[model samples]
Every structure is written in structure tokens, then in C-alpha cells.
Target: MTTDTLRASRTFSDWIPASWAYPETGATRDLRFDYMRGFVIPLLFATHFDFFSLLMFVGWERIGIVSTAEIFVILSGVVVGMVYGKKVKRDGLPATMPGLIQRSVDLYRISVVMILLVAAIRYVPWIDSTVITTFFDAPNNQTYQLYPPLDGSLSTLISKALLLQIGPHQFQVIGMYVVMFILITPLVFFMLSKQRVWLLLGISWVVYAIHYGAPFQSLRPTGAQFEYAFPIMAWQLIYVHGIVVGYYKQEVVAFFRTVWGKWLIVASVLLSLGFMFLTWNHPLPHIPQWITLNMIPAETFHYLNNEYFSKSKIGIGRLLNVVVLFISIYALLTLCWQPLNRALGWFFIPLGQASLYVFFIHVFLLLAIMNTPLPGYKDFWINTALHIGLLAVVWVMVKKEFLFRWIPH
Candidate 1:
């Protein structure tokens, strides 16, 4: 009954709730990034589930040119830089290569499995190929096809899947990750060690620039096969910059705390708003047009958007969108961490921590829902229920560590 004993008991009780009970991790681990990842996972799911009502809130291209994919890519780069970069410094590159190699192998293995799994579903007697085809087809007739026609020989299909030339279109991002980890990541670490950060960035920009003139046709091969959705050269720009920021996180944080850092944030906010206005009339479906500012000529708007804000190529506008928004958001989160973390952190943090697991498993859940005889996209309430249900299922799986031992996540 002593006051100290009572205080200790209260503290223990506070830790009982899931919000306060973060999983054990290294002291250096930043839960903020995990929370952001967790937040983006459901948005990604909602966007992927074609015609879901939730798209109104978090749909692709709904808010400016950026989407959850860009956030995920940048966060992935930051984490790699923070984790592997530190390891290189502590243990040297020799110790770091194995882990990077293993990560690439794991990504490749999972990607191949997903591709083969989807392709195998075609042969299942009960499952209709139409469902698979329908699922892959874009609602707006955009060529987002990831499923290849199995009309070819089985060996050829397998060969293409192994080569990462075709697969479940959802997993094309993973294939890109495999390639980056194998090739670009090590080079990033090497540059960081040698204090060649500018050189690394210069090289990344050069590669991204090459996309403008020649357009890196190899990644998006012209054929019947499923091409890579994210061209490696273009996307690497985000990931490389993420790595640089993550590796020097402390220095970066300190800089942001200074007067110059505050000015940068202010500039980022203005730039973000400017881009938002510029792309207000973007052509993507489901993007809510709250403000109608027809400032630019229609012809000029379309041409500029296609050339500068194109998502596939990580166009200049798109890159700028990612940068300004990332800075603005990161600053806001840092300023409001305590209350925001307490409010929504419980739900998202766990999901974010197990993001890869949720990501991989959701593919099956999405396939199941699409293949089943369910309510069509017309029923808004039903679609909303289904989307919420899908997120709930994955959240529970993550919290329970469902299949944690077996899955690469």
C-alpha cells in the first residue's frame, strides 16, 4: 500500500494494453517508420482491391500523384540504410554481404512462389480462369496485367516465372526488390562507408535521367510476358535517397531541428501544396476532385502529367511529390509523435512490424475474394465490409505471428 508500490503497479497495468506493449526490439529501432508502414499496408490493400469503396479515402492517385507504393519504397530504403549501414560500420562489408545476399534470395524465393502459385491456380479444375483474368484486368482498362496466358508450354511458363519476367502483377515490386538488393544495395553500402554519398546520389540521378532519353526498355520488355511494373533505374532513385537518409538518420534529425531544417520543411509544405494543385485535374479514376482549377490547358496538362508525373517512370514531378510530401509528413509526425502514437499506434504498429507477412498473405486473401461468388463492386456497404474484414484478418494474423516461422516475413 506504499505510494511507490502503488505507482509501480499503475505502471505495470499501463503496459498491459497492446498500444503500450511494443514487441521487443533493438534500442535503435524507430517505431515511427513501422507505424507509417502499418498505416500504408491497409491503404495498399484497399487500392489493390479493384472498386472497393475505401478507395475514396486511400485509393491510388487519389491524393496527388503519390501512392502507398512510393511510401513503402522510401521506407524500405530508409530501413536498409539504418540497419545494414550500421552493420557495415560496426562489422565491415565482409560481415554485411551475407545478410544482404540472404535477403535477396528470400525475396526471390517468395516472388517465384507467388508467381508459380497463381499460375498453378489456372490448372485447378474448380477455379475458373475467367476469375483470374478478371482480377488482373484494370477496371479503367489500364494495362496492369500481371497474369500471363498459360497457352505456352509449362516449361516456358516456369522459365519466365523464374526469370521474373512474369508473375502475379502484385508481386512485381518484390522482383524489383530482389534485383536492387542483389546489385544496387551493396554499392550503396560501399559508398556510405567511403563517404561517397554525393557520388552515390549522382549515380542514381544519372540512372534515373537515362530513363528519360532511352526509357530503360529492358525492365519493361515488349512482349507477351508480364513486364516489371516499376523500372529498376527510376525506382532506385527513391530507394537510394532513402538509404542515404536512413544511414545518416541522427545527423539528418539534428539538421532538421535547426533553423535551416525548419525552413526546408516550410518550403516542402509550399511545394507539396503546389504539386497538389498542379495535379488536381489528374486523369486517374476514383480521384476526388474537390477543387476544380482549370488553370492549365487540357492538352498541356495531359502532356505534362504524362511526361513529368508518370508513375511508371518515376517522372520528375512524381519524384518531387515523393520528396516534399515525405519531408512534410515526417516533420508533422515528429512534431506530433506523442499524441498521434498514442491514438492510432496500437492498431498500426503491430501491422507495420509484420508488414511483409501481411503483404504476402493478403495476395491469397485477395485472390480468394475475387474468385468467390460474392457481392459485386456496386454494393458500397458490402465492399466496405469486405475491405475492413480483409484488413482485420491480416491484423490478427500479424499479432499472432501466424505462420511466422515458415514465411520469409
Candidate 2:
């Protein structure tokens, strides 16, 4: 055979398609992500502890229309996009799947362990009813209960084991993350291969729209009712959106800097504030009765009207609030990150960096505090001390790498 023919016959090796490989890993570690996440951990703890505390009243949720849970979930998505998406972009599909699977497995293990730990404590005879009622108890619905009746116990355990039933106060949010990662894996790789993120986003939004109109709610072990806490189908849109932004961080940043981007940012802020005004107790003067609906009983109307702005469903108001807050923070950080970092970095950085460990430990701390005979909210000094103590312990844990080193993350 001729030399040219012989060369042609030889199969090419180590040739990766451009579509399959990225220019760089794009693995930039931004402290802002950690700081924001760290900031939310304490707020999440406080919100879960109770809704009457000073932190609850004047802090994360109170200052903004959206709850800290929105921030937490969105940040989780962005980080997942940055970390896992970068790995996929850099190394190609096959190389990234194993790590993603492993990470999901680890999260699942943590979720189950935490749920069981909380359940075990609830079973203790001396445990206070207040703690059980407040934290461990599931919402009063036929859908599911964390500590079910005696007859329902075995079924509840079975359902939880299968992840078909996740209690509200437990690690249901983490379980949703695990589910999203697993479900989105194939689509992510396919979309990356096609280089059509918009198509992926369109598909995601369709699901979100459908779910919003009529949610595909979670079922109880008995399959009798719907559970809406952090509804997965609807919330996955935010997660997927984060992944898209994280994967295309450069493009997103560039777009945001443009004139159109600035307008959108301003509009988002205005819309968010408007929605807040509509939902809050104080409505604007001179608004029509039909718009304000003064005809309905105020309390009943407030409850029903607020459903349009509900946190549990990630309603329109909450979604807008998060978007505006995120854009505002991003802009602020771009201009003043250095000074801001210097001012508040120490407080949130460590906790943010070791968020998983801090989050896991906070549950135990919450239970202990609730079980104590002290007045939880009546004594201002005691309440302040409890928060300070929890913060200090978590700070030390992160700094000392107590569970930070031990945890698989």
C-alpha cells in the first residue's frame, strides 16, 4: 500500500471534538458566592427556629419579600453550575458523570442521616412537645408527617427510604437538589453537546409554567393528598437557570453591563418593590377598591391574596424579589467588593465555605435550644445570647475544620 493510503487507514487517537471540550475549566472561586451562602445559613437557621425573633422580623425575609430559602437554592444551583458544569465543559460528558453521581450519593446519604437523627430525637420521651410541634412535626396535611401515627410509622419509613416522602422541616430541600441533579444530568450533557442552552431553558420554563398553573405536588405514603413545600418541578427552573448562568458566566456578566441590562435591572427593582407594597399591610393611598378588594374580610383576603406572593410556591412576587436582590448585590459587589470583603468577610466567609457542615450542625443546635426550659422569645437577652452562641460555635467549627474536614464534601 502507498504511504498516504496507509496513513489514511490508521485510526485517529486522542482527538476530542470542539463541542465536547471547553477552552478552560473556568473554575474561578469567587468569595462572593461563599459569603452570600454563609450569610443565608444563619438566616435559614433563624427562620426555621421560629418566625418571631428579631432576626426573623428585621432580617433576611423581613427586609426582602423573598425568604432566605430562595437565595440558598439559587446559590446551590449557581455553585453546581460553576463546579459540575465547568468540569463537564472542560473534561467532556463521560469524565463529569461519575463525580456528579458521587456528589448526589453523598447528598442523599446526608439527607437520610439527618432526617433519621431528627426523627430519633423526636422519639425521646423527654423531648418537648414544642420542639416536636414546631420543628419536627410536618405540616397538617394528609400528604405526609415526619413522625406519623403508630400504624403509619412503617409506611412512612418505607416512603422516606425511597425518597418518595420528604418531611418539610427535614432535609427535603437537599433531597430535591439530589433529584434535580440526577434528572437533569442527561439533559445537561445533551444540551451541552448540541450547544443549545436556550433550548434547554425553554424546555425548563415550559415545565415551570405547567407546574405553576397546576403543580405536580408530592404525595404521601398513602397517596391521599398533595405536599407543596419546596415543590420540585417549579423550583427546578431556578436551579436550571443558575446552571445556565454559571456555565455562561462571562456572557451573563457582559450582557448585564449593557444599556439594556441596566434597564432590566432597574425595572426588576421597581417591580419587586411594587409587589412588596401590594402584599404588605400598608397599601398605597388612592388605589381603587376593586384593585385593593376592600369588600372582602381583611384577614381572609390577606391570607388568600398573599398566596399570589407565597414563599412556599415561589410565587411571582418572591421570584421577582430574588432577581432584583441578586442583580443589585451583583452590581454592588462589582463596584465595592474589596472594601465590602474587608468589612464583612470574616463573619460570613468561613461559615459559607463550610456551609454543609454548618447547616448539618444547626439542626442539632436548634433542637437543644428548643428543649431548654428557658423562655425562647420572652427574654430578649436570652434570645440574643442563643443566637450569638450558635454563631460563635459555627464560626469555630468552620475555622477549626471540626466537621469541615470530616464531612465527605
Please, what are the lDDT tens digits per residue for candidate 1 over residues 1-409? 3454333223333333323333323346788888888888777876777654664455555556787778888998999999998899899988999999989888878878877887888778776644333334444565544556657788877887888766665655666767777778999998889999999999999977887667446544323133345777778899999999999987886686566876888899899888777766554444334433667766888898877887778878888888998887676555555567889888888988877777788778877887766646457678788888888898888888889987777
lDDT of 2 at 288: 27
Q: What TM-score do all the candidates reach, one by one?
A: 0.85, 0.79
Model 1 scores a TM of 0.85
Q: What are the runs in model 2 whose C-alpha is more than 4 Å off?
A: 1-27, 129-144, 150-159, 164-170, 215-227, 269-307, 405-409
Q: Which candidate number maximizes lDDT? A: 1
Residues 1-409, model 2: lDDT tens digits:
3343222222111232222211122347767788788778768766665533445443434446766767877887788777777778788878888888787778767766765566556557887534432333233333334455434566676566556353435345666666777777557656865698888999888877776777335422223111346766677778888877777777886676566876776676676566455444323232223433244456654564466566656777577778787776655554445566778779888888877777677767767777776544566567656676778887887787776554644
Best by TM-score: 1
- Candidate 1 off by > 4 Å: 1-26, 129-151, 215-227, 278-280, 283-301, 375-377
